[model samples]
Target chain A: MSEAVDAFNIMVYRQLKRFVRAKSRLFGSIVNPLIWMVFFGLGWSSLFKGSMAKALFGGYSYLDFLAPGVVMMTVFMGGFISGVTVLWDKEFGFLKELLVAPASRTAGMAGRAFGDALVATIQGALILAAIIPLARDINPGGIPVTLAAALLTGFAFTSLGITIALKISSMEGFHIIVNFIMMPLLFLSGAFFPIDPLPEWMKVLAYLNPLTYSVDLARISMLGSGSMNPLIDTVVLAASSLILIGSAALLFREATID
Target chain B: MDAIVAENLTKRFGELVAVDHVSFKVKQGEIFGFLGPNGAGKTTTISMLITLRKPDEGEAWVAGLSVAKKPAEIRRRIGVVFQDPSVDRELTGWENLWIHGVIYGVPKNSLRRRIRSLMEFVDLWEKKDTPVKHYSGGMVRRLEIARALIHEPEILFLDEPTLGLDPQTRAKIWDYIEDIRRREGTTIFLTTHYMDEAERLCDRVAIIDHGRIVALDTPENLIRRLGGDVVYLHSSSDRLEELASMLSETGLASDYKIIDGKLMLSVRDASKAMPEIFEAARKLGVKISEISYKRPSLGDVFLHYTGRSLRDSEGSWKETARIVVRRRR
Candidate 1:
């Protein structure tokens, strides 16, 4: 047990050092979401105000309606970027070194996932601070719960990213997958708009995507209103997280570390 | 007792066989060299022995634990330095060593002292706080050796330890390897394409070609078997076979071959046989454009066993094929 802890700590320390060294990556994780909140939210406020957005959000502004979605976006992008680090390690031969070391594969995956989740949380928090003053209707009293949701959601998506990174053979393939999977999931999750009025087919796809559940939960917790039941969304998000996290661990266990 | 042993070990990737029925044993405290051209399964075999890769057939025991069944035990008992550099470029030298020590379950107090001693030994104590990316190639290689030794395993495996380094640095690495062996009596298992490296460091060397051990013996014994002298006579024309027959008839030398328009022969004495060799060349009207004779090096031993030079054979067709297969999705 101590050995496993040591391995996890070492893995975490290594990743933290890498993150510190790569400042551009730190900026990239938060910059995307901050842009969405500031430019898009302000631009869309006059267009989306005093409609269902106001009613469902308890008279909240359009900027408030968009805040949770941007937070979830920050988590998702941060999680996806985490996988690129694993790919870098693979290309640089450090992955082989870690695999050959006297540590369990479980510990290795856990450490990497934790590091990714930590980065996601930090980026999400920073973006949230930037978005909070802009979204006047948001209740600052829910900050603690919102932060918890971001951490769990980030962890779930980070695990998913790591699982994909482990199975994919090359950086090019991973990039193709991120394009095919991440972008579409973000669109269908209703990050820019509510999912209630979408076509039946689109609704089903959104339900299937775990990101939608995360966005819905974030929306309900932060803005206090969304079309979906907040309780049901939380449950679904937690279950989806468990499934992906379990599968990631299994995939990491079976992965050939070479 | 043998520090490492393999019995008919085999590993396959899909239909391609990487390591085929390979078997060998290294007695405790011997610097055994596993010499092979790239893709002759040297790294694959070493990975299996270190419990990093699973063998498809047969079994290997490292420090008395079956590598197939008791990989964790084997991992605990062995240290590995991979061919590519493994040090974390982001971490300082001392931090890298400390992290490795901690992961390997070293006590904190002991680790502090070990890190200092190891850095000092590798001549990196002055730069211990600097990130590895700042270190020279030779310094990183030495730090890797230090990292491997931190756990103090009974057996250590170094895969191409001095590859891609200057000759001077390579010799320095060789000196460090020898010093470690003398000081600690660690069983060293290393792989190299450099004949001089094998000849200098390894107590016994196995020359592997095409996934099979072609020759296994002490370097001196392998060279002695090749008659201690190599004579290369490059002819102007492709008349090597004819010249070889004529030289045989003159009763000057034995064990000769005509390869690539060169008449390569081995003899006990080159000084005494040169006169007769020249006479035979003159009689056959063979133009000896280049005539060179030297004490039989490991290159001669490799040529004797595989009929090809080590330097030429590395990164050959087999390695190219392996890379193609490895790169395939």
Candidate 2:
């Protein structure tokens, strides 16, 4: 038990140390959401006022409606980019070193995924903190719940992203997956705008996406507003996290480091 | 007791046999060299023995634990240094060792001292705090060796340890490996394409080719088996076979073969055999362009066993080389 705790601390420290060394990567994770919040959210605010935006965001203002989406966007983007560590490890041959170590496979995956999820949660929280003065309606009563929602969302998405990265063998394949899956998941999950404004098919697909539940839960926690039940959203996100994490662990079990 | 024992261990990828019924044993404290060409399954065999890859048939026991059934047990007792630099470049050398030590269940009290000693052993103590991304190729490799040694396992496996490094750095690594072995009596399993590396460091070597073990013996014994001296004679292409036939007829040497536009003849005494060799060439209308007599090296031994030079067989980058290591649950 002591060994396990030591291993976890070491793994977390390793991640933190690497992150500090590669501040540029951390910056990259932040830039996308910041741009969306400042430029897109502001620009679309006037264009999406009242009826059109209300229909999409359950009657919230465009800027207010977009904050939760932006938080979820950060989670999705950060989660997808978490796989870059795996790519870097492969290229640098550090993956083999980690595999040969005495740590369990579950520990290895959890260590990395937890690091990414933590970063995602922090980035989401920071974005929320930055936008708090702008979105005055965001309740102080919901701060803890909003943070919990953001963390759960980050954990779920990052696990999925890491699993994809582990299963895909090449850098090119990883790129294709990120571009094809992550972008669509982000846009359709109502992160930038609401899915109700989109075609009927996309609305259904958005509901199916795990990111939607995260966004809904985050919005409800922060603004005390959401179309879906908070319980349902939490359940969906939690279930998705478990399934993705389990699949990743299983994939790691089967895959051999060359 | 044997540190490792592999019996008819085999692994196949689709239709291609990566390791074919390979068998060998390493006693405790022996430096066993696994010598082979690029696609000769040296790494594959090592992977199986290390429990990184599961074999399709047969079995291997590492430190008395079955590689197939008890990989965790095997992992606990063995250290591995892959051919590729496995040290995390983004972390400091000290951080890398610390993480590895922790993963291996080293107590925090002992971890710091162990890491310092390991870094000092690998000559990376001064640079321990510096991130490995700033390290040179050789420094990264040294740190990797240090990382592998952190747990103080009874056996250490180094796959092509000095590949693609300058001779000076390679020599330093070899010296470090030797020093570690001497100090700890650790059983070393090393793989190399370089004959000189095998000759210098290995107590015994197994020459593998095409997923099969071709020869297994001490380097000295293998060279001795190829005969005392190797005579390199460059002659006209037309008379190459004729010269070989004439040498065969003289029966002065037990082994003779043509390689790379030159006829290499092995004999007991090159000084006495040189006259007969020249006479045989002359009678066959062979005009010798270059002639040199030297004792048989591991290169000669490899060529004799595998029918190809190690240099020619390396760095193909064929699909066979793309091995993925997945965690086993």
Candidate 3:
């Protein structure tokens, strides 16, 4: 049992060390969400702050509503990069070394998912802290709940990312997924705008997106106003996190390296 | 007990059989060499032994544990350096070794000292903090060898360990390998196409060709089995067959054949038999324009069994002979 834990810790330590050592990635993760909150949020909040702003934004400014969305988006995008790193490991021949080790592949996969989720959650927390000054009336006590939502969302996406990386053979194919699936999911998940004002068909997609629950849960914690019940959002995000992580582990056990 | 035992192991890809029904055994603490040219099932055989690929037929036992039933146990007891460089280039050398040792369940109390000693043994102690991306090819290979030994496995499998290195560096790697076997008494199984590597490092060699073992024995024994020194005589006229028959009949050469209009002779001692050979050729009216004799090498043994040069095309001996004839014409 200790040896299994050792394997898990070794894998997690590797990812953490590599992630921290990459200075460019650290810089990018900080600057990226700022662009979304400052430029996009400030630009669009003006148009929505008129008489209809209270009704559309649940009695708050556009930046306030968009802050929670941007936090979830930060964690969401960060989780997506876990797959690229796995692909890079495969291409560079490190995956073979890991596969041949006596350690369980399931333990290694869980460690990787958790490590990536940790990094993504840190990035999400950074965005949350950065935007707290720009937006008003954020419940200080709800900060823990917002972070919890970020972590759960990151874990689910990281698992999904690894599963995709295992199934796809090439980085080019992963790029196609980024353009087609990831971007579409991000836009339709109510991260950039309110889902209630959307057409009926789009609302179904918003409801179906796992990110919608994460964004809604974050909104309830940060702003005390959300479209869905907080309990339902929390339950759905936690359950999906468990399911995705379980599937990723199963797929990882069958992963082969050439 | 034998460290490894393979029985009729086979593997196929589509319609092609990569590894045929092959069987061999390696004694404990002995260095065994699997010698073959490229695509001669060398890598495939090693893959099966290392538990990376499942065999299509037959079974293997590594360290007395079945590869089919207990691959995890086999993996725990053995270390492998793949044909391709498998080190993580992004991580520092120290980090790479540390992670590998930890994952392999090297005890935490001794892991640090083990990594340090391994790095120093491979002469990479100063560069341990540097990322592997900055390492030279030979350094990367040395680090890989050291990492494989971190857990002190019972057997070490090296697949073309010194490939693509300069002769000096290759010799250095050889010394390290020999030192490992001497100090730890670990069973070393290595595959290489270089004749000198097998001849110098292995206690026994199995020469594989076309997915089969053409010959298997000690280097000296394999060469001895080829009879003796080889003598090549090129005649000015097409009288090679007459000269071959004359030399064989007169007991000047133990065996003689005609290849490319040259009389090829296998003699016990070429220098002592040269006078007799010249006399026989003269009586047969065969003018020997050029004559050369050299002690048999592993290459000669390989050719005697496989009937083709190791460095040549992948075709069978008959096809190679036909190609040679066509080129001459």
lDDT of 2 by residue, B1-329 (tens): 99999999999877678789999999999999998777788888989988888899999999989988898877888999998888787888898888888888887889899999989988899998898889998998899888888889999999999999999999999999999899888999999988889989999999988798999999888877777787888876687877777776778777789877888887878999999887877776678899999866556777889787656666432545553232111
lDDT of each: 0.81, 0.81, 0.86
* Candidates' chain A TM-scores: 0.92, 0.92, 0.96
Ten-residue segment with the worst summed lDDT in candidate 2 chain A? A1-10
Tell me which of candidates 1 and 3 scores higher on TM-score: 1
Task: Give DockQ per model, in order.
Answer: 0.47, 0.47, 0.38
Looking at model 3 chain A, which ten-residue stretch has the lowest summed lDDT?
A: A249-258
lDDT (10s digit) by residue, model 3, range A1-258: 887788778877987888887879978987988998999999998788676887888887888989899999999989877745677777777888888888988888878888888889999998888999999978989999999898899889988888877777776777787888789889988888889889999999989889999999999999897999999998999888888888878877776545
Return the lDDT, model 2, position B290. 92
Off by over 4 Å in 3: B226-302, B308-329
Ranking by lDDT: 3, 2, 1
Per-residue error for B121 in candidate 3, Å, reads 1.1
Flag the better candidate by TM-score, 2 or 3: 2
